[model samples]
Target: MKEKTIDYVLRATWMAVSKMYNEEAGKAGSTMATGFALLSIDPEKGTPSTSLGPKMGMEATSLSRILRTMEDKGIIVRKRNPEDGRSVLINLTNFGLEMRNFSKGVVLRFDEAVKENVSEEDLRTFIEVAHTIMELINNKKIYKPETSAK
Candidate 1:
């Protein structure tokens, strides 16, 4: 058996989620995108999918479709950007905010449960290493060393 690592362990953990949330909230891909967008958005700018797509490693068309679905589900709303008429600002609906909070609570409880069994220092180190791995994977495309050149 392979030892649990970030990729395998995290995937397996999420794959084990059998709980059913509302269709609007249960979409893992959309939920994750919304979570990250909430983090990256400024209360002032309100966030736009155009800015969110690259950050979330999603395509423009895919993001658009996701946003549309979310809107139809009443999970989110879009408004024209005041500063740029051509752009739209994404805002969470009341239900959307509640869903975000609920998802966050689930994650927090899971973390606390893990902490109950692990040393604080070990948890800190594990998180730091995980963050480093995530940073590398997220920015892999930005590496520009011409290593194959003769």
Candidate 2:
């Protein structure tokens, strides 16, 4: 099989999984994850949208809108940075933490589903390929040719 074919298969599989998982997740899934990601980083220090957007590959404007929604829902709190008054810091509220925990359970159930559906060998291969893809895309690294031992 060609490398491009492998990429296509990987993308298709990802789409399928994501679609199913998102359906299961409903409105709570994506928003919950965003809130959880913010909480997971620095509870006390909090996270700035400026930093979080680029890291998540989300646009600042879009992130702001999401933040607004989360804020209205009481999922997160926005505080002014005392030192840097211009900066906005985001933190998860107790309600947000509970939602994040619920999302965790949903993700765990999805993991079990994936494990049951995909064989061990496939799962191993998928993990290696997924990590390679992440390293290539997120880490901006290239894949080097592996040398075989004689």
Candidate 3:
């Protein structure tokens, strides 16, 4: 493992970013996942509980636990979705709105700081590389048919 691979860099960078966000969230007595959830919910109209999992790329049990904690903290409330009687919508409370604003500011500041440091050309190239990697994975190009088994 003398030389690093692309996945290593991606994982390490993401881990660092996650840690930084968690630290920032700790100040407000929250976690990065909660902050993410707060941002994922629609500001005006509430978001469906079922959709939250897919939107956040989280699991049902995890989302349910976070939602329960948020509700207990008075940050959000669950109400019946008008359009779908069987579904429930998660609405942010006034405090949740304030928290969401705070979370947004943190993210904006992070983006601004990163943009200030990275040149536009480098940033564009980085984005293109990332997209290419995603495309490769999405199209199942990495692991293919037996044609390349040699």
Candidate 4:
């Protein structure tokens, strides 16, 4: 049988992991995206609305939807940034902070479980390979189309 490509394996693993997080978040009355946003925001200081999307690697539309839901749920609040009049900052509510802690714990537990099962060397190698793949993509080193195709 032909072996699976690295991209296939990476996509499959991420899908599985995302599903797992979504399931856990559902039990906590949240979605994976919401949980991730909560985790990305600072607990003490607020995060700029404009910065959150890029920080989370989320599109503006998707992030806007999630932010709306979070605001409706009273998980977060948007306030005008004192530092920048044009920008808005996203701040977590009391409930949002609690949810953030829950999300953090969930992530930590998953990491701990993986570390328990996988050898340290293997984990390091996996991280290195993942980083390399990210660098390659970020640098546009792969999949360059011919000039005629452009």
Estimated TM-score for each candidate: 0.65, 0.67, 0.92, 0.95
Candidate 4 residue-wise lDDT, 1-150, digit = tens = 299999899999999999999999999999999999999998898999999999999999999999999999999999999999999999999999999999999999999999999999999999999999999988888976558755
Clashes of each: 0, 0, 0, 0
- Give the number of the best model, judged by TM-score: 4
The alpha-carbon lDDT assigned to residue 106 of candidate 3 equals 84
Give the alpha carbon lDDT tens digit for every residue of 1-150 in model 2. Answer: 545686688789878777765665566646444543544435557777568787666777877787787788787898897768998877778877776666677678778988999999999998898888787876656655667989
Tell me the deviation in Å of residue 54 in model 1: 3.1
lDDT of each: 0.67, 0.71, 0.94, 0.95
Which structure among the candidates has the greatest lDDT? 4
The 10 consecutive residues of candidate 4 with the worst lDDT sum are 141-150
Provide the lowest-lDDT 10-residue window in model 1: 17-26
Off by over 4 Å in 1: 1-45, 135-150
Tell me the lDDT of candidate 4. Answer: 0.95
Could you tell me the lDDT of residue 48 within candidate 3?
98
Model 3, poorest ten-residue lDDT window?
A: 141-150
After superposition, candidate 4 runs with Cα above 4 Å error = 145-150
lDDT of 1 by residue, 103-136 (tens): 6665666677789999999999988987887788
In angstroms, give how far residue 51 of model 4 lies from its true place: 0.4
